[model samples]
Structure formats: structure tokens, C-alpha cells
Target: MIIPEQTRNNLEFDKLLKWLSSYAHSSLAKRIILKLEPFDSLENIQTRNKLISQCITLINEEGKYSFHGLANIIPILKKARIEGTYLSSAELYTVYRQCLLYSSIKQYIKQNKAIVPDLYALVEEIYEPSDFMRSIKATISEHGEIFDIASDKLLKIRKEIKEIAASVTTHLESFISDKNNAQLIQEPLVLDRDGRYVLLIKAEKRKEINGIIHGSSASGAAYYCELLSTVELNNKLKVIKEKEKDVCREILQKFTNSIRGIANELIINQRRSAKLDSLHCLATFAIEQGGCMAHFNNSSVLELEEVFHPLLKYKSSMIRKSAIVALSLKLEEPARGLIITGPNMGGKTVALKNIGLAVLMAHSGIPVIARRVSIPYLKALFADIGEKQDLMQNLSTFSSHVQNIIPMLNYSEEGALFIIDELGTGTDPSEGAPLAVAILEHLLFRRGLIITTTHHNAVKIYAESKEELINASMDFDISTLKPTFKIIPGIAGTSHAFDIATKLGVAETIVEKARSIRDKKDEAYLSVLEKLSEQMRDLEIKKEVWWKEKNQLEQKLRMSIEENSEQKKLLLEERRKLSERVKEFLRKSKSRWEEVVQEMKAALSEKAYSEGKQSIKEIEQEAETVLKVSIYQDEEPGQFGVND
Candidate 1:
């Protein structure tokens, strides 16, 4: 069956996909699926994906880090900043916005100073974005040039206002329809004084419109009166129209020059941001890859006594018994495969996942707690253990099992860890047991680390007979009627199914009869199983002791390293202090020479200069003495009081 990459489970995997959809301007989900190749739980993927989405949303919405918020947003912002055209650093953008607002408000106060009464009065006139406003904020979010143009619109408008006001002016005049009245005006014939005519002629108004024209007034008198009311109304409209016209012209002129310049800047930033984002993505990818590598690297990567499932620790509060399964015998070479034989619900599946996950976590640069685990560096990991079925292929339980196993058998390279739960269980025992043994042999030949759980006696017997394979199983406590997940080597595991059934209140007659039927032929083999089980218990204790010792040693080593680093820091500080003192001494000698000479003359009277040569020698000796004292006298750490 063809299984898509989406089949695997990661923590919040779906949410991660969604987050990636929003981020990187590309489908991050597909990248995640491709990077984290194998599957363990759909839930793991879903949860992990959700975490990523939450991280992006948290950064995009709140702009604050909760715990490792910066760690999460750094990659995204870095990606956005470098690879994204017109990408802005969120923090830097915020600062840039503040700077812009400061400049704008300052300019507004300076330019509109004549109109606004005060600071607050001007603020009242200026537009502020409302809380409910729902438009895209940053212009040129996609195109660099367009955003730049939109952002600079206000400045362009201001420039336009200056350009148009240079030629326009206001003029005042009166009209007279009577030719006799026209004689009073003299000089030129005052154009149209047609009072009722459409006020079609556009000329500069020289004064405020306050009153009405008289005598020649016709039916249009009331309309003309309305038009000529106040100077305030006329001037404001003219200014507005002129500014608008000039602004349009400026924008058209700039359109040709600014596009390529802005686009280049945007592209550069986009590439840079993408590179930074790639580094962060690589780190996360490493974590996922490393987890898979741990198991596949070592042949006998066992969590002997105190093994815990990395993923399961948070799932249940109930106490769990740890199990051990050894495939070291299978590892004749450095990497060997192990076949684990145990009953149903005997912690077999848990063991398989634990081993796989532990190795994976280790490879990811995380520490794993194990009594003793031998690990090699592995390149890839494939796990097919629990609830893996191919309904799409219309395959049954047995068919699905075979399909899953085929990949491990065919594609797995040497030094890879392959884990299977209840191997060869879906078919008849006769066929499945032999099939399971054959697969184990094939894997062994290839030197792949194979850990399989089984209930078949034939498989267990087969492993025991082979010098290259070892048998291990989980123990059962008869008194408690509980499966004591303790694993024992060189032992065949008993299912204890009947005992468990009896403890669960199965019919007494059926329990007794079943016990009687089984007690006849395999008595000798069961005896060996009991001895091997005892030995497995002892191995568990030894494993725990070894783990404690290893932890203690590691702690001591860490402490020693820290101390050494601190010592080095102290030595460097001492050297710096010494250098500073020497510099201070040299400076003091030049600055305080007069004071030193006066003090020296007072100490060595007239006799000091009795002989010219002797005086010179005495002065030289005094200078040398001062230098020696300055160098030898211990100054306080970081202090440099240079005295001449």
C-alpha cells in the first residue's frame, strides 16, 4: 500500500502544518512531513503541529514571548526579514513606526502651527487609527514600491500645496451696469458686471466675500449672495483643489524612478531573512531527525532496569513495571538484531517504542536515561509496530502486517534499528512462527538492529538454538497475578494467561482443568524458564546500580569543567588589571612632573647638586626607584591611581 508522508504522528502535527501554511509563504506542513519521515502516533504529529501554530500566532498577535517565545519567533521573523520581499523586522518595524510618528507629528506641529491653537489642538485635527479599523496596515506588504508610495503620500501632499500657491491670489472688485456708473471706475472697462450671469469667469479673489452687489442685480442675486459670503470658505476650497492636483502630478513623476530601487531593497531583505529562517528550521529539523537516529544506530540499545518511555511519561500516573529485551547475542557484529519473545500485554510494544524513541531522542541531542545503552550514529529510522493498517489498500490485519515487515526486510541498511510488535502473530502459528524466524535471520544477515516481540514458542526456541540470538521476556508475578514488566535474558517468557484469567474471576473448574492439561509435557522446559526468569530479575538490579554510578560520574565531570572555566576568566581579569595599571603610571609621569620635581628638590638639598655629573645620576636613580615602586606595589583590582 502506498502510504503518504502524512501518515506519521508528531506532537500537534496538523497544527504545525497549519502554522507552516501561514508562515514561510510556502506549505511548511509538507516540508515537515518530508523531514519527519516515519510515524509513531497521529496524535504526536497533531500536537506538535499545533504547538508550532500556537507559536506563530502568539508572536504575530501578542508580540511578546511566553517562555521561549523569542526562540520561536526569531526563526519566523528572521525568515520574514531576509527571504521575504518587503519583510520588516517586527521589533525593528515597531521602532521604525514610532520614529515615523514622531517625525510626522513634529512636522505637523511645525507646518500647521498657524492653524492649530496648541499641541493638543493640532492632535485633535490629526487622524488616529481607531481600535475597530480593519484594513491591511502595512502597504507594500507584497510590493515594495507601492507600499513606499502609499506611506509617503502625506509628504507629497504638503509639497504640492507649496507648488500651487505661488501664482494664485485673491482680488476684490465692484460692478456697475449703468454706463454713467462705468465713468466713475475710469481707465479699463471692468469685465462682466452681469450680476445674474453664471459666475463662470474664474479669477483670483482679492478680498473676503461679506456683502451683496447692488442695482444691476437680477433674478440670480440671491444665488450670487450665497456664493459670496465669507473669505474663510473661498480660500480653503481653493487650497484643497490646488494641493490635490499637484500631488497627483508628483506621484506620476516618481512612479517611474522608485520602483526598481525599492524592489531591489525588498529582494535583498527577503533573501537575508530566508537564510536566517533556514538556520532555525534546520535546528528544529535536527531535533526530529536525531530522535529517529538513536534507535537505529545501535544493535543492542536496551533500557535495562530503569527505562521509561519518553512519550508515555506524561500519559498515565499509574506505576509501570519496566521490561528488558536483549538482542546483543544477535549482534555478533557491532549491529545485530534481537527477537523478543513474550506474552500479550507483556510490555512488548512499550519496549519497542521506548527503544526506538530513546535512540531518536539521543540523536536529537537530548539525554536518555538507561542502565546501559550502546548507541551508534544512525542516518534514518523506520518504526512499524502499533495500529499500522492499510485500509486504503483493502488489506486485512495479516496482509497489513506483511506489507509493513517487507519494507524493513528489503530497504533497511546496516546499523538501522527496526522494531516490530507482535511479529508474525496475525497468521497461523506454524506459518507465522517460521516466517518470523526467517525475517529475523534476514535482518541479522544485513546487520540491522531488530527488536521484535512475540508469543510463539517456536520463535523463542529458534532464537535459543541459534548461537547468534538471545531470548528475553517480561516476568509475571504469580502472587499478585500481575505482569511484572521485568525482562530476563536467556529465558522463554510465559503468558501466565490462565493465572491472569483466574485472578480476573474466571471459573475455578476451567482454570484447574487448563492447568492440569498444560502441566504434563513441557515441565522441563518451564523449569528452565523459571530459572532464567530469576536471573533476569538479578540483571534488572545490576542495571539500576550501573545507571546511578554513571549519573554521578557525569555530574562530577560537569562540575569540574565549570570550575576550570571560571578560573580562566579570573586569570584574564587579572591580566587586564595589570595592563591598565601600567598605562596609568605612564600617564601620571607626564602630567605630574612639576610636582614630583619640587618634592625631589626639597628632599635632596643643595648637596644633591654639588657635582654636575652626580646631580644627573641622582635624578636618574630617583626616577628608577619610582618606576620600580609603581610596578611592584599591588593596586586594587581594576584600580589605577598613578602617582608621580
Candidate 2:
């Protein structure tokens, strides 16, 4: 989205920038945060989301990663790019660190292609040839000290430097140990002074010494002197040291040549890495804030639920985070705008701000702190939230608001979201309220999402009368005389100016007088609104209580049903076992009766049949009683009578 700079400040997107930029590892990333704009294409936005997903994974696993060459090399790179000069050894080391970092990442991405496909794809965009990195690593030490192996001539000259330095050390040691020269020596320590080896000698013995005085001691009692015998050798060493520097520069120049060969690669690498860093920071911010990604659509269908303002979400130390309420605003085809009216300090401004800030954040590709949010991919934002008085230009707040609104009216697109706080507030309501309605009409005609707040009763009444504009309010508790700090949709606030004034210590007599001075029709209208607000407030509280109780009942009912079902299964299992026992008893009775009947028949022929019949009747009666008892036991008290 291409919002104006002033619009950014009005939406307080800078505060969001501060929060996001804290996680940036480089100036490049920080600059990206500052210059954030919505991507021009949906593909680009999805690409960024993919990058963010990878960054989130990386960060959660290993935490913060350092950016190599960020501390000292950025400015040097710029200088090299503009000036085209050979770099020093230390400067080349910085570039080497950068190259090494990217090289390592490239290798990692190549190996873990399946794990981090998006990140690996991003890494593939850079044309980093590892040949220069290998050369630089072989040449430079970890401490930025160029190795002797960097150049052959430099190595040979350094070998000569060591020899010359050894000879000079021998001469200085001999002079200190000499009995004749021992008395002249002060501390007997040889030191390098102005690129020449020198000895601290007594000032009184300076005339006896055959050397040049280089510097005097702080007390002026001794002189720092270089021996006349070692001058030729020192001069030769100086010449070789200069050559060493030239040779080192030549080696560094060779590395610079390697860089220039892949100049385009370096630029591409930096660009891609910088974009990666930016994504990393944004993802870091989103994770910290517990936010989710927002998608875009073509129409002005804005549906935001449970979204907190960025300022309130990020820098709300003074306010309790749990106490801060998330706002919900939806604007569809018929509902083109929302007109919110509420008591002072009742979060109307914050509601308006949340709408604008969320739109901007989504358009800029930073996820919003909402459970679910869908907004139009707007091209511009129109906001008039803050004090816009221009002292130098002699413009009033109304004039400034009008000036901002003018451009918006001319260029505002169909999917734009307009946020106006306390609209029609800077002037007399008699005229300002009508102006606000007229502007609302204009915005409706343009077909955009407009969310505005006002205390003007006329604005609220007009909004209530209109079918297209929805009236909303921040609920306030009349009993406690405090704001509930919640947005209640389809209800207009009473805007109890007199009640608030009285609560703030205005005299009761003054309140009464003010009430008496009002027009009867206006007073009656305000009175009816206050009554409606009370009714709505009570209704909302009751609704909340009802919903809470309903949820609790539902949970309890579910638990009870589950427990009863388990108990019923146990009962059914027990009944099944009892029925099997009854069957077993009947089988045993039949077997015993048959055996007895056989014995009776053998004992007495005439009475055998009658005895068996009696035995059979007794067994049948016993089995019938057992079945009745089992049936009675199977019918549990609640199970038989209560089923939905």
C-alpha cells in the first residue's frame, strides 16, 4: 500500500516500526522497516510469507543469529562502490567475513533444501561464487591481520624485516650491558620511538653518548636516544617495511579485483540477504506479539475480530494487557461506514485507531494481532486522528482535517479504509455534524470502508436513521460511572457530558443549571438515549451471564452423559453375566431331575411318570422367578425413566 508519510504518522505506524526494528540485525533490515510498503502483487506477498515461515522456524530453534560484517564493513563497502579504490587489509577482512557468512549459509541451504525450501530458494537467488571466499580465507587471519603468505614479495620483505630487527635488538642489548654505557642508561629498556628503536639515557651522559636524541623524558632529566651505529640498518628496514606495505596493498588489491569481478554478485547477495534479514525481523516481531498473517481481497469487505492496536499491543506497560479489549469491526456491501459515539475516555479513539493501524499493517505485510482478519489490499489510507493544528500556517484543526480529507475525497479508491477520530469535533456541532454526514455520504458514494467517531448527537441520530451506516458505541457503566472500554455494535452511546463533568468534580448546581439551559427537544432526545444505553448495557450484561451459564451447563451435561453411559455399559455387562448364571442353574436342575427320574422309574413302575412331572413343574417355577429378578435388576432408576 502506498500511504502518504503523514498518513503513516497519523496511523502511528512508526510505533509499529520501532517494535519491529528492534529485532533487525543490520542497517539494511532497519532501513527496510522504515521504508515498508505493501507489496504490489499477491505473489510477492505470498513469497514474503513463505520467507517469514522459514525465519520463524530458524529463530525458534536457534534464537538470534549474528550478521557478519555488519559492524564495520557497510560504510566501507559504500565507499568502495563509489570510489573504486583498493581496500586495506583490515577492510578486505570485513568483506571476507561477509563472504564467509553467505558462503556458509549457501552451503547449509544446499544441504537442507527439503527442510527450508523457501529459505533455500531465497539463498539460490544470490550469485555467490565461493572461489573469492576461499581465496580471502586463505589470505586473511581471523584478527584482520594479513598473513605473510598473502604475497611472495611481502613474505620475503617480512623475513628481511625480522633479520634487521634482530640486529637492532642485539646492538641495544649490548649497549645496556656495557660497563662504560651502563651508567648512562636510565631504565636499560629499548623502545621504539617514532618508527626508530631508541634507548632512554641520562641527560648528563648525553654528551658522552654517540647517538641522536629523539625525545626527552617527562621530567627532562633523561633523553630517548637512537644509536648512530644502527641508523643505516634502521633506514634499510624502513625501506623494506614500506615495500611490505605496498606488497600487502597489492595482495589486498588482488582480492578487491576478485570482488569487482563479482560486483553484481555482491550487490545481489547483499540485496537478497537484506531482504532476508527484513523478513526475519518481521517474523520475529510477529512471533513476539502473538500475531497472525492477514490475507487480501478485492472488495471493501473488512472483517476484523479480536485485533488490538499496535501501540496498545506493544507499548502498553502503563495499561494492563489483559484489561485491553480487542476490537471487532466489519463492513460489507450494505454497511459502508460505522459512526461510533461514546463517553469521553471510553476508547472510541482507540477503536478508530485499531481499524486504521490494522489496515496499514496488513497492507505492509506485517501480520496483525487478530485471531481472524481479512481486509482489502488498500492502495492508500485516510486518517485524521491526531491534533492537526499548524501554528506556523495559521490552520485550525478543522482546516487541517478538511485539508487531509480533500485529497482523500479526490483520490480515495474503492477499497480504501478511512479512520477519523472525533469527526466534526473542532467546530460548532450545528454545522460540523452536517459536514460530517455530508463527508460520510461522499465516502459511501466512493464505496470504501469508513470508521469514524464523534460525540455529536446529530451525527449519531443521522447514523441511526441511515440504513447504510452502522452505529456503534463503547459501553459505559452508569452505576460505576466508568467506561467498560468495549465496542458494542449497533448501539449509539449517550455521550453523558453532564454526568462526566459532575464525576470530575463539577458542582451539582452548575450541572443542574446546564441541564436547565438545554432545549427541551434535545434534552428529551438525550434522555431517551441515556435510557436506551442503560437498557442495552443491562441487556449485554445479562446476555454475557446467560452465555456463561449456558456454556457451563453444556459442559456439565456432557460430562454427566459420558459418566452415565459408562455406568450403563457396566450395568449391561453385569445383567449379561446374571442371565448366563440363570441358564447354568437351569441346566444343572434338568440334569439332576433326569438322574432322579431314572432312579424312581427303576424303583417303582406306576409312580415314576407323576414324580418326574412334579419335578419339572418345580424347576420351571424357579427359572421363572430368576428371570423376573434379572429383569427387575437390569432396569436402573435413571436409565429406565430418563432419556432425551
Candidate 3:
């Protein structure tokens, strides 16, 4: 999306950028954040926002991670990219530290990949040069010093130098201890002068020292001289020291060559790391500011719920969160323009700026400070906020405003946003109000989404008359004679100038005289607007009460449903237990019947035919009585038989 420079300045977008940059870990990341612009494609914007969201998740799951060792390695990498150029030990240490940071981040992302897949994906694109890091760690110390173990030859040379230096010191001590030469020496202590051991000797006894004089002291009373006995040892030590330096140089060059081999990978890793750092800053800032990514739609409708001016949070240290009033606005089909009317210092301009900033922030892939928001992707954003008087061009405020607006009108397109504050105010109201109406109509006809503030009653009336326009106002408290800083849509606003003046200690007589001299038609219109504002306020209170009652009812309904579900579960469990008891009772009754039938058969086999018939009859009667008793004993009161 193309946002004009003037619009960005007018909305104080740079202030937000500054806030974002403050959370960056390095200069590279800060630079990237400061130069952020709105992406032109929805896919890119969504990707950026998703990455930030993932970062937020990571921070919440694990406490914020510190990138302490991360540094801008671009300059060092550039030098390494050139052939035969070796980085200094300190510079190479910086590169190593950055590599370690990369590895740490890679591991961190891998551990939390399940929670932050998008962040993991972003880190996965960067190369992890484990071999390169191991080489650096083996060569350089954590304190940016080259270690003695860097190379075999360097170590061997250092060992020889250490032995020779000890031998040279031994020779110097032996010469000093000899009583024959003790008087020639002014002081026995040896001093290191330009990497060679020397001794202080009396200037008058210099000829008796038999040594090479390095220099004389400040008073010229003493001479610093190297003893002749240690001269050969000192020369060997000097030659070995030079050799040690050559070995150290070779080690550093070899390390630098290794870095150069992977210079391209390092460059790519640095860029990706910087981008991740920027994402971290953005996510942190969003969380601090109570922000969320707004839903984007392809339609022209714009909806904002409980939206506040983002800068208001930093406006004053004494300002509490509750002191900032959030406003809600919705512009759908046929309402292409919103005309806000209110008295001076009533926050009409603030509302306009907030809307513009919200759009810009959302388009730039930054979360907006709002409870809920859904905005269309705007092709262009043009704003005419604050005074535009151009002293350099000798143009009046009205001329400058017109000049700034002419291009906006020409470039008006579908899905474009235009925010104008105190529109058509620099010229005479008689002409400016009608001109403002005409301009608004033209912009709406071109299908541009517009939000403009005006104090002109003509513009407000014209907005009320048009189906394509909606009239809104910054709410004022009549009892307190102060602006509430709350925006109310679908109604015009009264200036309430006289009432406010009276409250501010102006004489009642002045207020009455001013009111009487006002135009009758304008006064009547303001009176209606005041009454309408009162009705709107009452309606808002009623709506809030209704919403609370509705939520309570919904909660109660959910509880009822859950209670019913639990009762059903318990009822089914009880039925299963009762069924098992019935099955056991039936099994015992069948065994009793089988025992009676066997007794009847035994009686028939032992007696005549007539006796057998009598015996069977007796058994049948006994079995029927036993069956009835068993049924009565097993069944509970009010419970039917097995069929039930």
C-alpha cells in the first residue's frame, strides 16, 4: 500500500517506529525496524504478522530470551569476504560470538517448534555453521584473545620464548648479584624497555658498566643499560619473539580464511537473525501496548471496537488506563464517508487520527491497540490533518489545504482511506461548508473511504441528507460542561459553546447576549442535536444494561444444560445395576422349578396311576406358591416384573 509521507507524519507513525526500535538488540535490527513500511501484498503482511504472533507465544511460554552476545557482524563479514584479508582477534571474536548466538537460537527454536512453528520455520531458513563455530572457539578465547593452543607452531614458538626470557632474567640476576659489578649499578631491579631487559646505572659510572646504554633518566643522573653478559640471550629472545609473531599471524590468517570460506552463509545468517530480532521487538512492543492483529477482509466495510489512540498511553505518566476512552465505529455499504462535528478541543481530530493510524499500523504488519478490529486492505491512505499553512509558498491555510487535497481527490479509488481534520475551516464558513460537502460527495462518488471532522452545520446537515454519508460526533457531558472524549455515531453534535463559556466563569449576561444574537435556524439545529445526544446517551445505557442481562441469561442456560447432562449419566448407571439384580433373581427361580419337577417324577415312578396324578397335582400347587413368594421377595415396591 502507498501511504503518503505527509500522512505518515501527520499520524505520528515515526513515533511508533521509535518505540519499536527501542526493543531491538543490535543496531542492524534497530535500523530494520525504523525503516519498516506497509507491505503491498496480503500474503507478505500475514506472514509477518504470523511470525510476530509466534514470537509472542514463545515469550509467554519461556521468559524473554536475551541476545547479549549478538552483534552487528556485517562490517567484519564484509572484510572477511575479501581474499587475503584477515580479521583481527577482537573482530574474529565478535564473529564467533554471533555464530554462537545463531546456534543458540536454532536450538531454542527447535525445542519450542511445537508452540511456535512459524518462528521455527523462519529460523530453519538460516544456515547453522557448526564447523565454522568450532574452528573459532578452538582458536580464540572468550575474552577476544588468541589462545596459545591455536596452532602447534605458535605454541612451540611461545614455549621457546618463555624459556629464553627466563634464561635472560637468570643471567641479568647473576650479573646484578656479583659484588664485583654491584657498585656500577645504580638500582638492581631490571626493567623492560622496548621488549628488552635493561638496568638503571649511575651516569658517572656508565664507562665502568661495560654495557650498551639505552637512554638516560629525566634528571640525567642515571642511565638505562643492557648488560653485556645477557646480550646474546636477549638477541635470541628477540629473534624468537619475531618468529612467535609470524606464527600468530599465520594462525589468524588461517582462521580468517576459514571464515571467508563460509562468508556467504554468515551473511545470510546475519540477515535472518536481524529479521528475527526485529520480530521480537515488534512482538514485545505489541504485548506492552495491549495490541492484537486485526482481521483483514476483502470488502469495503471497516469495523473497530473499543479503539483508542495508541499514543495516548505515553501522553502522560499520570494518565490511567481507565482514563482513556475507547470508541467504536462501523462503516458499511452506502456509508462511504463519516462527518464528525463537535466543539473545539472535543477530540474530533483525535478520532480521525486514530482511525488513520490503525489502518496504517495494520497494513504495516504491526498489531493495533484495540479490543477488536476488522479493516479492509486499503490501496492508498491520504490524510489532511493539522494546519497546512505554507509560509515558503506564501499560501494561506485554505490554499495549502486545498493544494494537499486536490491530489487526494484525483487519486481516489476503491478501498482507499482519506482522513481530514477540521476540513474546510481556513476559509469563510458560508463558502467552505458547502465546498466541504461537495468535496465529500465527490470522494464518496469515487468510492473512497473518508473520515473528516468539521464544525460547519451545513456539512453536518448535508451529511444527514445523504444516504452515502454518516454523521458522528465527539460526545460532551452537558452536566459537567466537558467533553467525554467518547465518539457517538449516527447523530450530529452541538457546539455547547455558551454553556461551556458559562461554566468557565464567563458572565451569564455575555453568554445570554451571544446566544440571543446567534442565527435562529442554527440555534434550532443545535437544540435538536443536543436532544438527540441525550436520547443517544440514554439508548447507550439501556443497551449496556441489556447486554449484561443477556450475558447472565446465557450463562444460566449453559449451567442448566450441564446439570441435565450429568443427571442423565447418573440415571443410566442406576438402571444398569437394577438390570443385573433382575438377572440374578431369575436364575435362582429356574433352579427351584427344576428341583420340584424331579420330585414329581420320583413320586410317579414309586406309586399307581391314580396316586401319581394326585402327587403331580400336589407338586404343581407347591411350585406355584413358591414362585409367587420368590417374585414378591425379589421385587421392590412400585417396581414391575421383568417386562418393565
Candidate 4:
């Protein structure tokens, strides 16, 4: 929550803010975004992040909600708070527009509250001034003009002014139509001068016009004069116009008083609207950059999966999405420091800076550009990246770095993140490497979370020897003589300086001489490291292939299960139909037997006693025949039968 200004600059936090500001619709929202800082409490951060997620859901389901016509109405609202201050038509129109925007936003949230409950909660406090908005709408037109229909008195005054203006125009036309006066006129058009209608007359024949001159033209060749006949009419028109102005002023005053009565509510609404706009901007930026909110853990463990630098992904125009490789980092308990080693331009420093930037973004409630992330709630994040040489202070690079690291050491404690780039580089290898190792040890002892990039063998060995430290490296490809820009943990990296020089067209003799000058043990160590790096790359390829095969197998298994389920359902349906056929056959046989019994009973009567035995035999034969036919009709001859 307490990141130094220098650290923020190192991580390019200001540039990130500028990118966020671009998504905002109103100046007020932009201002809020530009001044954003990390929240001090986890609860606040979680709330803000949830709001952004809810906003994204709302947008996906209902399309983007419009925030157009929203302005910074705080100043206007404050001015309206004065007792007798009357806002101009344009000023009042701005407030009216904001009111309408608020209403629309409120309605949108109400309709989609299920999709974005958190977003709705955020705007629930917005005060909707419906009455005030209606008053302004009825009084003012869209072009910031007071309508004549604003009040009956104002309407009557406007009508009277219209009539007087018509009379003046008629008198002027009659005067111009006279053949005698036509010669005196300079042009056949009427000009309005100082709210008075007049005719352009020839300056030389001004004396013959018998009218009072209003003004002269720029060229002094023409005079604008009002005819004596139309003078009284012009006066009436001017008087009526003044009356209309007074009436319009009174109407505006009435509205201004209404605004002052609800000034506090308006201010509250303005703040809430600005907050909603800010959420919109944050959500839009996160969606554009493929960012997600990170889970905050109470422990000191920090994990990042497929994380990209915010500046690289969002700010760089030339870099393709595929070209920007993501970095994965994990620092857990028992290991408080991470020492990264690699050849130059291998992305070691970038990984270090990215860790710091992720922490800052998480604390500030802006989603990080990562597939997944889980970071601790850091109390402070300190980063010393890039060159710190100060020519004005005449300080050496080594001294400058030490000056910056002193505070980091003083404030280093649990829940703090320390990032140092190219550690131990501005001095002699033997002394600088030892110094960097000591700094790492001190920070680790204080339980501080530290990530540093180094090329020093001492620092790398120290990282390997301690259970509280971890060693990581950026990958380099020997075949192409280029860096892969991938960070691999649990292995110390080799610089590959001589090999790189040989590939870069350095003379063979020079490369060989440099190799020979190197210590034998050191060269052998580097050789082993190179072999280890090669093996790691091989293992990564094998893992990728294995994962692809696993996924294919899983897909096949799912299809098989679905096919089996469908077959079972079909089997059950067939059995059901067979059972229905059996039941129907039994019902028909029972009905036939009952009819035969009735025939036997009728034959047993006294008049038919002699025929009883013959009738019984016939009934038995009929029953046997019915049984055979019903069984055969329902299924195969021997497939089913009552006795079977």
C-alpha cells in the first residue's frame, strides 16, 4: 500500500494509469483514475475488483451501458448553492442532461440487477432529482434557450413584442415603397442596429430622408436611419422586448432557487455517478487487455501464471501478442528470496519488474494481465530497476545503487516486496557479488519478499545453498544464438559469453583465447549448466506433448460415455413398448374367455340340458383357438405364452 514514487516510476505505473484513463467517458472519471493508489485494506481491494467483474458481466449480457453527456457537475452544483445565483441557460442544461443520464443508468442497473448485483449496490445511493429535472426540461430548450412557453406571463410578453416588431416592419416597408423616398435609400434592405430596425440611406441624401440616423457604415458612404413614421412603433417594440427579458430572467431565477434547495442531493448524485463511470473505465480496460482479478492470500506466498508486463501488452504497438512471452513465478514459504541468473537480454530483469508491477496492480484493485495469479497483501513494494547513475550529484553507479538500497534495507520486513535488477553490476565482480549476496541474506533474515536479477556466481551459489532462497534462470537457445525469454526455476543459468561471441562473428582466435583465459573449474561449471538447460528444454517439449495426448484421451473418453448413455436410453424405450404389447394381448384373451363362460351357462338351462355337453366342448375348442391366435399376433409363436 506504500509504494515509493521512484518504485512506481520503475514499474511504469503512471503509464498504466494513462492507459486506464483512456477508457473513461467523463473528465471526472479520468481524474479519479489518474490519481489512483493502492488500497490499504484487503476488503476495499476485493470490493473494487468485484465491482469491475460485475460490470464486465453486465456489459456482456446487456451490451455496454452509455455514459455519454456526463460532465463534472460539482462546480455547477456549488454555484447553484448560492442563495440568489441564477445559472445561465447553458449551465442549467448541463445539469439537466446529467440528471437524465443518471436516470438512464439507474434504470439500466435496476433492470439487470441480477447480472450485476455489486454494480447495482454501488449506484444504489445515487439521488435521482426527478422534479428538478422536469422543471428544467419544461423551461429550457435543447439549444440553451428559454422557451416562450416557460410561463404564461413570459409567453404574453413575447407575443406583444412580436406584434410590435410586425408593425415596425410594415411601416418601414411602406416608407421604402414610396417612389420619392426610394431615391434616398442606399439599399432596399432593413438592418437591425442596437435592437432597432433601420434602413440604409445614402449619406449625401441623409438630409432629404427626414429620419434620425442610427449609425454610419464602415465606408462612411451610407447611414442607417429609422423613418419618423416607424419611430413610435420601434419604441413600442424595444419596450416590449425589455419586458420579455425581465420575464425570462424571473423564470430562470425560479429554477435556480429550486436547484439551491436540492444542492446537497445533487452533489451526492454527482459523486456516485463519477464512481460508476470510474468502474466502467476500469472494467473496459481490463476486458481490452485480457486481465483478471488476482486472489489475495494471507500468507507470504506469491504465484503468477502466464503473466505479461502491463506496458508490453497494452502500450506497445509493434509487439504482437504471440511475441510477448508470459512469465510464471512462485515464491512460497521457507523461501523468502529469489535470485535470477541468465545471459544479457534474456528477460531476467523483465521478470523481476513484472513481479513488482503485479503486486502494485493487485493492491490498486486493477486486474493484472495474467491467466491466473495469487499474491500476498504486500504492505510495501520497493523496486530498484534500470541505471541509477546521477551525473549531477557526481555519484558513481555503485554509489547510486547503494543510496537507493539503503532505505529498502531499513524498511525491509515481512509483507514487503523488494526487486533489484542486475544486482552487483557497477563494481568489481569479486566485491560486488559478495556485497549482493550479503544484501540478499540480510533481507531474507528480516523475512522480506525479495526478487533480484544477478549474473554473479556467488549470488547464484548462495541461492542454491540456502533453503530460504530459490534460484531461477532465463533460457537461451544455443542453436539460434538467441534468448528464448522463458524463465526456468530450480537451475542456475550460464552466461554463454564466449559461445555467443563466436556466433556473432568474433574472430575464432579471439574467442578461443578468451575461453583459454577463463578458469578451468568455472568453465566446467558453466558447461554443466548449459547441459542442464538443454535437458530442461527437452523436458518442456516432452511435457507439452504429453499434455496434448492426455487432453485427446480425455475427449475420447467423454464421447464414449455420451454414446453409451444414448444406447441405454434406446434399449429402455424398446422394453417399454414390448411390455405394453404383452399387457394388451392378456386383456383381449380375458374378454374372450368371459364370453365363452356365458355361452356355457346359457346351454346348461333345463330345455337345453342335452346340448350342454356339446356346447361345453365347443366353448373349450374356441378358447384354445383364441389363445393361439392372440399369442401369435403379439410375438413369435414360441417366444411368449401364459404357461411358459
- Residue 77 of model 2: what lDDT? 64
Over the stretch 331-390, how does candidate 3's per-residue lDDT look in tens digits? 988788888888877878888888998899999998888888898888899999988889
> Which pairs of residues collide in candidate 2?
1-38
User: What's the lDDT of the predicted structure labeled candidate 3?
Assistant: 0.78
Q: What are the C-alpha RMSDs, in order, of all predicted structures?
A: 28.1, 20.6, 23.4, 23.9
Candidate 4 lDDT, tens digit per residue, 306-421? 98898887646445445577888888987878888888767777787888888899999998988999988888889999888999999989998898888888984577889998
The window of 10 residues in a row where model 1 has the poorest summed lDDT is: 64-73
lDDT of 2 at 333: 66
Give the number of colliding residue pairs in candidate 2. 1
lDDT of 2 at 282: 83
Estimate the lDDT of model 2.
Answer: 0.73
Name the top TM-score candidate: 4
Clashes of each: 38, 1, 0, 0
Off by over 4 Å in 4: 219-221, 316-322, 479-481, 564-644
Pull out the clashing pairs in model 3.
none
Per-residue alpha-carbon lDDT of candidate 1 for residues 1-644, written as tens digits (9 for 90 to 100):
12223222312224433332232322332343334433354344333333333333333343422111112223433343343133332432332232234334444344534433333232333332321111123422322222334436645664554443331212223333435434333222222233121122112221233334332224422223212432344455456656654554454333323322333333333333332233234324333322111232323443333445544442332256443233112233432556665556667666676666555544433233443444555544556677656689788777887877776777646656667778788789889989988988887787666677887777766775565666677665766765555555545686667767887899999998887787443544554455445544643554455445444433443344435646545544554454455446445543443443344344333442122224234433443343332212225543222222
How many Å off is the CA of 549 in candidate 1? 9.9
